[model samples]
Target: MWLLRPPGVYRPQPDTWLLVQALHDAGIPRGARVLDMCTGTGALAIAAAGVGAGHVTALDVSLRATLATRFNARVRGLPVRVERRDALTFRAARQFDVILANPPYVPSPQGDLPRSGPSRAWDAARDGRALLDPLCVNASGMLSSGGMLLIVHSAVCGVAPTVDLLHKVGLKAAVVARRTVPFGPVMNRRIPFLEEQGLITAGQRDEELVVIRGDRRDDQP
Candidate 1:
């Protein structure tokens, strides 16, 4: 799909496509409400709108991203509520039928998430769970009785932790999709630190991107 990306906004890469595919597999019931968290270029949001989400809310911390999402939705003739809100911090007005996120999971050398720059799109702290952890902990709180959450990230951040954390919170989480892709520029550059973090070995070059599904037990179909 064609998308408009402003300077410093994240370009849709393989991870984005994986999320889109997983969303497709999940299926959207007509009039189902959807939320796209950390919507970068609004690709997922637009697609959700296209798939018949009754109301789609796209939230991002970047103005450029929000504008890109709104613009894409407008050009596509879809109704999407684009907001410059930090998705992680907002209390949803109501639980959603489905929630999607493509958050920063790349392990960065820095101890803190970036304050600016393109790194903001893919940089989490050293452990790489800066965003993932919170998202898992809070997911059950914002989902409807039978809602589901889909998130994409690299295995380098430890997929088991994601599932384990979600399980702790009473959500049935599992890996549903996996793809091994050559390391992109960012991951290639972080190889040394990743090795130091014991996330990769000396000769590791391929990283597996995975889509994890978390659904309320009572709502599983």
Candidate 2:
């Protein structure tokens, strides 16, 4: 089950792997419907199915990534539905019990991205929170009642602001888990930006993995 991953698509992050492990540890029941947003290479979705998710839907904006996911799932014999659509534009007819997303958290101005490859994964809007804010706002609608939304991003994205955005969207969010990994290609550029923004003051640049969960609630404004 090996296919060439798209260039801009971020490969699976260590934190994402940790989050999946956390979900398994928390006992995400077998046969539960799960959605993996911004799915790259179908890693999380495939892992979910392997761990007992009844069904898994993997969504990504890149056609190449989706195709890769489809091929990966087929090769592994994992039942996963891969969708090629913008995460912001795509909608699910039915809500999901478990939703996982590892979006583009790097802050980049429009048209700033490289022509293609891993660079696409690194281009988040200015302030790094641009994509994150919208994702939280729409997350409420995408989740089933009592459903959980799991997301991972860099600490340089400003953890406080990210939490604030989630709260603004009516999702009670928390940092359920975190992991620090050696800085890589994505972090190489992001680190300096974060420093200039005063997001990080001192310390070596280490990739931060944050897991935020939004729990569905009945009470609504």
Writing each residue's lDDT as its tens digit, candidate 1 over 106-199 gives 9999999898899999999998889999989888888888889999999999999999999999898999899999999999998899999899
Which runs of model 2 end up more than 4 angstroms from their true locations? 1-8, 109-117, 218-221
| Alpha-carbon deviation at 114 in model 2, angstroms | 6.9
Q: For candidate 2, lDDT tens digit of each residue in 11-44?
A: 7668668777767765777788899988888888
Off by over 4 Å in 1: 219-221
Residue 38 of model 1, lDDT score = 93
In order of listing, the candidates' clash counts read 0, 8
Candidate lDDT (C-alpha), each: 0.91, 0.77
Alpha-carbon RMSD to native, per candidate: 1.7, 2.5
Instruction: Find the 10 residues in a row with the least total lDDT in model 1.
Output: 212-221
